[model samples]
Target: MAQPHDAPTAAELVAAVREFLERDVLGSLEGRTRFHGLVAVNVLGMVERELDLGAAQDQAHAARLAELGFADDAELAAAIREGWLDGRYEELKSALLDATRDKLAVANPSYRS
Candidate 1:
């Protein structure tokens, strides 16, 4: 976690820009420009959330796939489609839920709540 960057770190830089957009840019624009600024703010928020949660989510997903004896997502999808886990429906359901929650925690955390 050593932030050996020049001055403002990545998170700090993102925060600064987001604050600027929210406080300054958003109010100055009208019509389509304002709409686009709103979208930009949302996209920036998503990027910040991903930066916060993406690494841990990826690690957990890879570990889950490994535990399930699959090399990757495609293999897992193939197994699911072929009804290979029919007997373990509950377990599969829980795993899929966890995966979805993890993704949503980054993509749209409010939905997870």
Candidate 2:
């Protein structure tokens, strides 16, 4: 699905490293080393998902924040802290839920499932 280029794309390279850890590295480890390898695998999975979805997620997040009359996250947070959104609790809850779901879709899709 990628444009014409070499065989190994950046995502593929990351997947390779992740697989190596999942197989070879984890096999020879125990205790903290194994735990670290597991953590590394989780980190790599997040990285791969970010590589696939970070751009679109960024655009959606910014647009949603703008829709609430804020420029960005910091502005939105400031407004919330100042009790500006108190009258829009339902809207705020919906927006927050959508944002959290989007984040989980990247960080841990299975959890969403």
What's the TM for model 2?
Answer: 0.88
Q: Number of the top candidate by lDDT?
A: 2
Clashing pairs in 1: none
lDDT of 1 by residue, 1-113 (tens): 34565766676778789889999889989999999999888888888888778889899999888878788999999999998989988878878899999988877789986
RMSD of each: 1.8, 2.4
TM-scores, one per candidate: 0.87, 0.88
C-alpha local distance difference test of each model: 0.86, 0.88
Q: Which run of 10 residues does model 2 get worst, by summed lDDT?
A: 1-10
Residue range 1-113, candidate 2, lDDT tens digits? 36876878878888899999988899899999889989999999999898888889999888888778888889889999999999999988888888898899889999884
TM-score of 1: 0.87
